[model samples]
Target: MIGVLTSSMAIVSAGGLLFALGEPFIYQVTVMPFIALAIGVDDVYVMLGAWQDTRRTLAPEKRMALALEEAG
Candidate 1:
């Protein structure tokens, strides 16, 4: 999903920046990005499920807000 990919990219970019600043890419550094990606994907699924459960009678904006609320 877009959200998962973007979050993974951000994490990778941060790690890359740290590497540019002389930080070594240790074993832990490699593992963290995958953990973050997994968490992000899980969150996306939760949000999507919340969106599906929202009332159709509500306006689109309201439904989105409600989904976010439930997801949060």
Candidate 2:
């Protein structure tokens, strides 16, 4: 969530800077931040679900590796 918000803010700030510098803004540039937010949220949910499915018997590092592998 923090990553998502930070990235989105960066994108928007860059876009605003470009616009201020006389660059022509397109609709997609305005919309892309929201798209990124959605994708970020989806990725988090997938990672969490994968983590939950990992075997409890495994060591913590192995469990994390499996979760990331499955999610990725």
Candidate 3:
């Protein structure tokens, strides 16, 4: 999923920055917070995607069922 891809890119970028030289101890401390945030964001995106898929799958049948009830 795009969320997974974006999360991976974020992690890789963080690692790359850490090793690129001139990095400070404060930067190392920040990684944990950034990782936590990234994971939380990814979870939200995944949940939203699942909710959208469920809605898409159910909406048409629900509408059709309503229509049939009205007709009968």
Q: Runs in model 2 with CA error above 4 Å?
A: 9-23
- Using TM-score as the measure, name the better of candidate 1 and candidate 3: 1
When 2 and 3 are scored with lDDT, the better candidate is 2
Worst 10 residues of 2 by lDDT: 25-34
> Per-residue CA lDDT of candidate 1, range 28-64, in tens?
6668878888888888899999999999999999999
Best by lDDT: 1
- For model 1, which pairs clash? none
- Point out the higher-scoring one by lDDT: 1 or 3: 1
lDDT of 3: 0.62
**lDDT of every model, 2 decimals:** 0.88, 0.85, 0.62
How does candidate 3 fare on TM-score?
A: 0.38
lDDT of 3 by residue, 9-50 (tens): 777787688779766566457567567567857676655555
Q: What does the lDDT come to for candidate 1? A: 0.88
Clash list (residue pairs), candidate 2:
none
Among all windows of 10 consecutive residues in model 3, the one with the lowest summed lDDT is 63-72
Model 1, position 58: C-alpha lDDT score: 99
